[model samples]
Target: MTDLNVSVSRLSPHQECALHPSFKWKPVYNLECVFCQSTLCVRGMKAILLADTRVELYSTDLPPSGATVLVEEDYETRHCECRIKDIACALCGNIVGYHVMLPCHPCLKSCNNGHFWMFHSACVQPHERLDHNSNSILLWGSLPTSTQDDQMHSSDNLQWTECCR
Candidate 1:
């Protein structure tokens, strides 16, 4: 079983005790699969407003639909006016959370254009929530070719320092 201290909640006013106030609604770390520790999305992907203050919505370019298999069950919320599909880890098959597409809410755009993963905070492991003002670690994406040589060196140092300390 995943070493998740946080409990999953489907109800609104989600378990607030599990979240850090500073990063409660902010993308402050990578969202990883609780079962396999595989990264699903990173911090600062994009933010979306949801009706629930307890639930924070973030947009991910990580093949939102294709990567994970959706469960047979789905839910439609009148508040959001959208259909939600329960998404499971493609590898471990754990019910991570759900995603909504083309919701009626103004804050939430049509996810059909891209897609948004409404992850259950408990279902995801928040990695690298460290506060640093220095050269930000490259958690995802490739370094530009021009700065590749310099960045690789700096990235190694950053990782070592971050990991060790």
Candidate 2:
């Protein structure tokens, strides 16, 4: 047998979520993946949600047709579906994450996994459910580059920082 990550989802109301005042419902440490420990960072440091997270929607290179089927579902008022799409990261040459095509963006996005196909009302256009034409297809790009001194940087550098000053 293998170990599975245990978790609790005590998501509450009156916290900021996709649109309403509701909790963001993230794991402890305001983190994403505990294993890889990669959360969207900006300005050379950790990014706090909303403090940093802006609702975004990625338009697909294809018209949501050429991708492979993954999963789909419907609730009393919402629906979702996942698809596999090809994507490339601009920073480094690595691949990750599902191009999860949801019938809607109210579902999951980023977690222990990097941001997947997710969207909020702000990311969508008015009078429409999806702005697929303007959205960038979600993809696992590249891991953050690092230096010998154990510092994470965007570009390639052989020299490492001495003490992270």
Candidate 3:
């Protein structure tokens, strides 16, 4: 298999363009559920930034203000029709994420479906990770215990923030 992990500084201009520079970490291939290894979304999938909020992933904190944190578009294989979809591991049925419902306001009429995909970084494991300063790193087939510790403690002092339903 090709080494999907590539250092950010060495990325081709085209590849850089494909990424949201504001995001701290990005996957090199489609993410898979750490529990079941079921594919979730492909690498280079653009995320939609929610205003003035941060999400607590398993190991890292995601600040969405200027980052591509929420995935609005679903990959072809993981499409859902429910207004509030549950993102589960296909093989194990472990709920790993959510498809939150977006309000249908006057300004937003394009997404008639009223929902988007948001996978918890803690629940899904990336096959390859893009490191800004060094070569891409390979993640484990399952989430590491240290990462779980990070996720578990990240929300302790956080103020309540609104997320999609």
What is the descending lDDT order?
1, 3, 2
Give the per-residue lDDT of model 3 (tens digit) for 34-113.
Answer: 78564544332224323212643321222122112233453322222334444564445677666555432431443221
Residue 87 deviation, candidate 2, in Å? 3.3
lDDT string for model 2 (47-137, tens) is 2222124523322211122111223342222123433343322222223222444323333443322233332222222121111233322
Off by over 4 Å in 3: 1-28, 44-52, 56-83, 103-115, 129-165
| TM-score of every candidate relative to the true structure | 0.49, 0.22, 0.37
- Estimate, for each residue in 35-110, the C-alpha lDDT of model 1 and write its tens digit: 8765554432334446555555544444222335678767786566677788886657897777675456664542
Higher lDDT: candidate 1 or 3? 1
Task: Point out the worst 10-residue segment of candidate 3 by lDDT.
Answer: 156-165
Cα lDDT of candidate 3 equals: 0.39
Cα displacement (Å) at residue 66, model 3: 32
Which has the greatest lDDT?
1
Model 2 residue 134 CA deviation in Å = 36
Model 2: ten consecutive residues of lowest lDDT: 137-146
TM-score of 3: 0.37
Over 4 Å off, model 1: 1-28, 43-49, 57-59, 63-67, 109-115, 129-165
Q: Please count the clashing residue pairs in each candidate, in the order shown.
A: 0, 12, 0
